[model samples]
Target: MEIDELTPAEARIWRAFARGDYVDFRTGPDDDPADGAAWGPERTVRARVLRTLLLDGPRASGEIPSLDLSGARITGGLHLQYATVELAVRLKNCWFEEVPRLYAARLWEINLSESVLPGLIAHAVRVDGVLRMTRARFTGLVRLAGAEVTGSLYLEGARIDAPDAEGPVLQLNQAALGADLWAPGLRARGPVRLTGASVTGTVHLKDAVLDAPGRTALDAQSLVVGSSVTAGCLDARGTLDFRGARVPGTLELTHARLSCPGGIALRATSCVIGELWLFGDGRIEGALRLRRARIDSLSLDPDLVPDEVYLNDLTYGALVPQHPAERRLQMLERDGDGYVPYSYEQLTAAYRRNGDDDAARRVQLAKLRRHRRTLPWYGRVWGRLQDAAVGYGFRPLRAGAWLLSLLAAGSVVYALAPPPALKPGEAPDFSPVFYTLDLLLPIISFGQETAFAPEGPYQWLSYALVLMGWLLASTVIAGVTRSVSRP
Candidate 1:
């Protein structure tokens, strides 16, 4: 297409592209036309004309060819599938007639900020520079699966109102970005898929709102990020899945509100995260799942309690702001999976590592109490007895107290009524204290018990004392042995 053969608007844009000048034709921000019907010739450009200039544009010696346009209404399909363009294309504040197709295309930088488009498709495309679409609005699907970007992909302040279709509204599955995938202040009305995507830098989703009721809002399964995924203040209405993700850096969702009523609000099952920080006063309306997740550290707000959390086999190496077991042990009891011993053990080990032996012992006591509920009726009765007598081996001081109480009670009853001396004059002299002591210590028989045989009610009291002695001794030994066997 020669200069004279081109339309006047196209000729002007051609001269600007040759000089690498940015062409803005709209009068003001309010001059945005939904269609080119009301637009002047200066504000209209065919998609083919833009494509032709991008591919065969005149480049000055030692100067890079560029095409930067603003406020232009594109009038046809901008299909760049499998086409290689070396210039940086910036089409800001433009209204596209339809979504562009850049499937498997090798391109340089692409910036479509503040544009209104049906959607975008750049599947399997390779972009040498950054792909930016900040503040752009997409009414349909935005596919970027298998894309390889050398620089970051920015979608800040973008509003995508793509309702549920055949797949996710914003698809970046299996894409590889060399730098960050920054999407702060992003608003999406459907599912945003990032499954199997790899980002070398952080994935920022601060102040984003994602709404996909009764379905997954953000599905980043198997996502491998080199740095953190910070989604502070994110409002996720549906399930946000990060299962199988390997984020060596922290996955910080501080102050993020999650709501998926009657379903899991956030699922990070089997994820290997360096830290999972949820330390703010965030609201969670549904279940939180971390089953089999292994986090190096966790920063949890003591007041931020989830109603239903499945922590079966979930292990964290350390806890931020670690407190005593009284304040922290309630979290282990809140597991909805019902009696996962691993959760208690993991917490116990964490407390021990902090050199808080008192906290560790308290956790052990809680574990036994939780386990007792799963036993049979008879076993539960025995468990209750041991709990009251010695706190399931965690409270050794209670055992001593119970023994002293029983000994004092037995001595008082015997001292009030003297026992009859056996064999008349041949028996030893009666001593109430020694006689009571002899009955209680079943293993050693003192001569006072053998000689002074009690009569009537005193004899029955002696038998009761002997039985109680054996029971207390057995329970004490069992509890002590349990404490010694572990740790």
Candidate 2:
């Protein structure tokens, strides 16, 4: 750590730090240094000097003096892998010729705000304070895989451009953050990945622009967020995948615009969330898949419509809609695919839990209608018959009505017809009502129709009565069976 043992470049860097002067190698003799202020450097420091300073610098107060490399043009890569530093490293407005590699390094805090860098490779790095990169621009991939940060990761107004189309602009797989991941106004030319990451605070991406068409723009599968994942006014041209993610707080996407035609705009399969808010001018051009997701509550805009939506096995405790019931029903009907029974069932359960039995019944009825429409031709026919005769087993009274009508018709026919001849040893008197009843009742016989012999047209009339009676009996049995089996 002695200046005499340090190289000439290291000595110069130490002297500049002692004098509180910002280092700069890109400034010309004719250029006014005062114009650059604290960001302007008198001379450039070698990469080795910077590394040595970070590794062996003396502590000031309780930490090393803040290393200000603002406006400095670094010659080579700054490799701080596994190095421990106790002070803030400020590289504001600097330009890096090579990507800085900080793999497995432990730092107090690092600020690359407003810096133009090739990229950053900080996999497994640990930061005790904020990783501030506000307004910084990256020309390549910024990988932070397995990183642990005790403070927020700020990337406000940051612009990232990756060379590979399929690679992510920012990779944060398995990263753990103690605070919020703030990235408002971020513009990424490639995808942003956060797979298996855990954020203790909210992940805010308000007004961010992501353009990774035909691919995943934001892949946060299996991410565990302690708070909400809010992305208001976001414009994403590709898919936003959140499969198997768990959010204790709401996942808000207010005023967002997502377009991934012929592909999924958002997929949250098997996710568990406290609440979901897709209201306030949000529009998704492709399918929004929520298969097997468990949401405590859902809030959707009355007018918002995605091109296609899949809610198979999606269970929500409530549907918080500000619109009327009719409008809400219409919105539920917006799913491009045919009727899904679980969606209707989930809604019905929600209404029932809210103590609105009437609404729940209405939803159940609607579910039946929608299900009937999706049935095959033969199923439709059977359904219609059941509806007409027994109200799809919902109103068993209708079957009773049919039976009464058939019985009355049989009585009228038998009464108007000529009297039938009685067999030998039979009763002398003949009662038309008793005769009709005997023909109509298939299970029990009063012996009136069996002892009597009907003539010509009367025989045909009795046959008709018997057939009608059998049909009504079968329909009633079917209705009862259905009612018993229904959930």
Candidate 3:
């Protein structure tokens, strides 16, 4: 308790502090020998205030006034009591097997970054100024509930081990974080319960894992996580019950596995999610019970719900239930077992309510096509026939015109071909066989007056041969042209 009674190291550190040497204190982990005996399996640090403040490195022991441990380690716990130190304490890289209780301590900055605190077995730890822990690790439970953290509290990459190796890790039952509770990569081997805890700013749990009895990674109910609750992936096996919580901006559970007693209950009467994705067996019952919830999108895989889910009074940019029927079975159960079908009638009614007939008709047509299987077989066949006829009716006209043009062209070709004998001025026969060629031509060319104008079957055969040869030549020409153009 006296100046000369202190150890040489403690004397030197106290002397430096008295000389206003704020930046210079004991350095290195071996600066204090008190740590080995202070916080081993047995916890006892009977050393007075001046001894601790003077020569204690984080791992070493002995404390000084306003311990400047910006980057140091304490192999033992720190017991700083009634020390009138301005910028009071800084535990930058400190670890503890157990803690030495403090009393009437007025501390300013406490930096516990990159430090492993096995447990804070202290009676009470209090702080006044900023506590910046950028990447601290806690192996045991830390109780800083009633302590007033005036400035920013940063625990960005903190790892708090489960409290009861069987219970929750860090239980902030009634803690009040004034500024942002920035614990982005904070992992807990047990469930992290912040029920009834309040943070003025944001509570960032972006990539933290909360492992507990029921598989819930993090459990916060009646707890206020400021404007947003942004979790990257939550594996909540037991009920991740958020029954009466309120999130302002968004509760993004994009790729979270949710499980509950009956099923997971987002059933927080009026909680909203900007975008919610139900991945791993994410089933919900008791109404996705968002009495007046709002969301950007609610997406879920059809196979995720093994049984049934419900969405009651929920609103979103789009409520895309992978299996809406499952939700209907729970919430909109009218007429015993029923659901709101996405039918033409419903769609038309929606558009009609909006006072848009064009939109109503469009939606009706879409619904008709989508649920076409719901129609009777005869109705389906009739619809198909009508559709096909409307689409390809003009094709038959083109075919008919081509056939008629071909017949007319064949007649002209027959007339144009050199007749066996000229009639001089008579009309040329357009029949399949020219009668002049079979009768008149033969008599005129042979200089014989045939009695009956060659009216025999042989005469008919001669005319048929000429017509067949002409048709064959025309077909061969057309075939040759088609083959040459084909790719």
Candidate 4:
């Protein structure tokens, strides 16, 4: 407990916190113009060595560089529960707006490397060891980056970890991730940089087994894991180099076993993800490129990408495919058969880019009869109605339902025939149209010229029983719309 020994005016506030020197820590101590706790050279000796270890409770390890306590104004909660201090508490260029609060402050193998931690609120901070924040400037909302304890939130060439572990990584690179930043099992040997840091949120690291034998590379560049992150699972099997990372949401990678080299590139260009399950104990041999990813919904969730993986320039949703077979089930297993056949030539190339080719070929024949049997799908619905009756020439609803069901069944057989009395003048018959017009009756009704008609005979059998009940209800509604328009 002897390291707090500096005094030539506290070594100029510890070399202005080793040179980050921001200065104006809210003004006023009036340089001993007679007490107000006398402050001067830019502030931060970590608030007077943490207010002399919270009023002298645990200051023996090295007594903190000899007490001048730099601009002095540190506040409460410096409770170092187990007390065993060794030294290396160099709050680099620290200027925390008066060390507001930090509960279980157990900085075990401490080294807070290069700090300038703006408005920190160390909620559950129990770094049982290393917390080296490489190149810090962490303004406000650090919210413990979703505190879970165990250690290893390191940040290699770090610029930002949490401006809003859920709402604001602003400063361009937006943000969003309410929780789950759990560090897997965390035995971190090295390799964990938020490369070129612009992280909005989600850097989960599920099952985190970073053994980094000699550490080749593990950068998470241009990182903008936004879209308010819902689940979280970036399991890095070793060399994860998210080329230009931008995962908008659900990127489970199911059993995430990526051994990386050229694997997981999600080819960023504002890559907007949401539903990308990529199933089973993962293994991206080299290229999972997703060229310019924006997949709104592509869940291969069943086993997690083993329907025989392929991927490239992917286009499953979020619109962009004009029909080269929409191309996104990109080989989730082909030859050995991890099942494909969502036919109608891939639902007519995803309904010609989602216009709805006969409802995407009836949901690709109802998901290919739920698992195939040589999908006849009614002979592909009579070959798509005979290719819409011969290459989309058009049938006008089957020639207007076969000429309105043969004119409503020949007007119900000529209104049940047998009433041909225009005989009084005789010339009216005109010999039934000269010589037997083949017993003519396809329909020729012209009988309403009555100055005194309806003379009797039950009024012509009540006008032929109301014209045979209106041609039998128009031939039973055109034969029930041609039996529900079959296919």
Candidate 5:
């Protein structure tokens, strides 16, 4: 298009593009023209004219020319599919009639700060510099799948509402970023996806509001981040998934309100992170998935625990706040996914890492008690015997007390009523202590059990003592063997 073919507003923007100057076309206060429909021709620049200026404008003499327009209404679609533009595009406080299409377009910096647009489609678009959409509002979908951003992408204070869209409201699946995804106050009505995305720096979602009730609000599966991904104070209504994600730094969710009710609230299965902080009195309304996740430091608050959790094979180096062993044990039991031994072992290990061997032993005992519930009736009965006599081999003092109590009772009863000698002609005189010891010892012999045979009630008591001895011995052996082999 020639200079004469451009409109008066387009002519002015074209002149400014050549000279590399910023143009403010608003005649009055900076107010949005309702849907960009009420704006006059003086403030409306057709998208074709801007595209021509970016692609076929006059050559620059010294500095690189840029297209920076503010407070102007953009009419028609600014389609730059597969095109190469070597300049910056800054359209601050502007309103668009049609969404900008930059599919597979290679460009420099692009800033749409405080602009109101229908949506954006820049999937597979390669950007050399920063892509900032600070405080911008989108009423439709913002697709940026497979985009390669050389610099950081900032979406602070931006609002993207496309609750009725077929896909995510802010689609950024598989995007590769050279720097951080710094969105501090982002608000999205529909789901915001970042599946398979890679960021070299941190992902800041602080105080962001993501609402997609009965669905996934943030689907960030397989996302790899170099630094921390902080979602502190975030208010999400649906699941915030991080399945198979790898974050080398902390994933902090302090003071976050995550609500998904009978569904999964925050799923981070198989995530490998430095620290996972879910503390600070946050309200977690649904289940949390930490199945097979490995973290260095897992900081949790007792009051912030969710009811249903799947923590099988989830290992952590340490648990912060150093809650009492009993409190931490309750957290492990909340794994409503049934009895997973690995969860107990992992929690015990976390306690042991801090030199709390006593707490670790308690956890082991609790594990046995929990396992008993999943066994058959006979197994459970045997388990109860071990617990009563030996505390599942975790408390040696309790085992000693049980042994002493049984020994004292047997010795007194045998001393009070001595059993008759079996072979009176050859049998030696039987000592009451020796007889009681012989009946109680399952393996060791004191030569008195065979020498004397009690008749009637005394015989019944002897048999009962012998059976009790065998049961106690077997249960103790099994519990001790398990504890020793596990450690």
Candidate 6:
């Protein structure tokens, strides 16, 4: 574009760019501009100048000058709402008096690293390249709601402090990113919301520190990530909600420290992930809710003991624990109220699939024992009796042993006792073993007990023998039925 075609402000900005001057309010001849500041004319680039450059600059030659307003104090906020920019915007080390607005705008790329701004409002904006804000500091909310980035979104070493404690410091709700969302070393004083956001690559938040006590420190509900969501070494002070999120890769929190006493520290209800890792030095002070979550594999640290954990309906294909089976069993048992039979069943199946039948049986036995403990007093008593007599109907041999012992005792009693008195012209014929068997069998009959009745103490002994026979028979029958009917 020719110089005459530009307005006075645009021309002035063009000339200042030609002279490599930094656009600032105090760039006048009388004023002493800071060292390393641009050598522009004694005039700041007004918002009109910026608008004209972005709207009218030639796109073919890429002749748009780089906005090197580093260390310059922008008097007014930059408003690019609904505008399109073909050039990159670099405002490194700059200070903004007001938050920049880029609502619904399309830009090539943005670089605001090391800048101190009130905040940013870039709702529905489309960036063809990265939205770099590394080492930047924001004093207010940085809203990127519904924005789409074709490249990664970098916020490493950034510090965000929202004015309102209840509001999020960085809001990316419903945003779509073509690449990863890197936020390592981030320090946010308020919650970071990424609700319903979709990322094609990983969401890395390693070594980040978030402080939003009694509220969500990081909320990524319904988020869909193509790769993993890793937060190793993260220190979060409030709830980290990942409800309904889907990740094809793992959701790892290897060395994170979460604290939200009496509240949910991590709530991942209904989430589906390839793998879940809460191993290593991760510690959660509050409850960790994983209700209805579906994971292909889960890895938990042996020593990790959250204050409270809920695992209702939480299904996993395998449990990858470094600890022994006993330790893992203990961990599951510690969930007291949250423990469910299906969880134990799932573990049993996994172990069985791995050809660890012993472990699987042990898990089954533990489950039964735990369930028995949870039963009422009467149920428990019955369970104990079944266990001792028939091993909950699993040990048929035990029932047979009790029957044998009763038969032997009855035989000895009858053999040692005096023979029954003979009637007139009747010969005394008594076989103690046969007599015991006949009485105990109930179906068969021999003349001993019926024809020759016991006298005195032997009569009481006969009644005792009949009662023992009935009890033994009933227990054996019940055990057989239970064993056959059990799944």
In order, candidate lDDTs are 0.88, 0.80, 0.48, 0.41, 0.90, 0.78
Q: Provide the RMSD of all predictions against the true structure, rounded to 1 decimal.
A: 1.7, 5.6, 17.8, 17.3, 2.6, 5.8
Question: Which scores better on lDDT, 2 or 6?
Answer: 2
Q: Candidate 5 regions off by >4 Å?
A: 4-7, 26-36, 411-435, 443-456
> By TM-score, how accurate is candidate 3?
0.52
TM-score of 2: 0.78
CA shift of 392, model 4, Å: 18
Model 4, which residues run further than 4 Å from truth? Answer: 1-90, 93-103, 106-123, 126-156, 159-295, 298-307, 310-323, 326-330, 335-337, 340-353, 356-487
Candidate 2 Cα outliers beyond 4 Å, as residue runs: 1-13, 16-45, 58-64, 163-166, 301-307, 322-340, 369-380, 395-487
Deviation in Å, model 1, residue 123 alpha carbon:
0.6
Report the lDDT tens digits of candidate 3 across residue range 1-487.
5666654544544565543344322256554422322433221222344335533422223533355433222334455655434554554544444553344455667666665566543223445666666776666775554445556567777777654675566656556667767777776676666666666766676666555544444556666656666665554444454545656555655565555545443444455555555554334322233444555665555544434334344455544543323332333332111232432344345445556555544443343344444679986764444323221121234333433444454444444452342343443433422333332232223221121122355345445534544443343344344334422
What lDDT is obtained when candidate 4 is compared to the true structure?
0.41
TM-score of 5: 0.92
Model 1, position 461, has a per-residue lDDT of 86
TM-score of each: 0.96, 0.78, 0.52, 0.32, 0.92, 0.79
lDDT of 3: 0.48
**lDDT of prediction 1:** 0.88
Model 4 residue 190 CA deviation in Å: 5.2
**Regions more than 4 Å wrong, model 1:** 29-38
Question: Which candidate number maximizes lDDT?
Answer: 5
Number of clashing pairs, model 5?
Answer: 0
Sorted on TM-score, best first, the list reads: 1, 5, 6, 2, 3, 4
lDDT of model 5, residue 287: 94
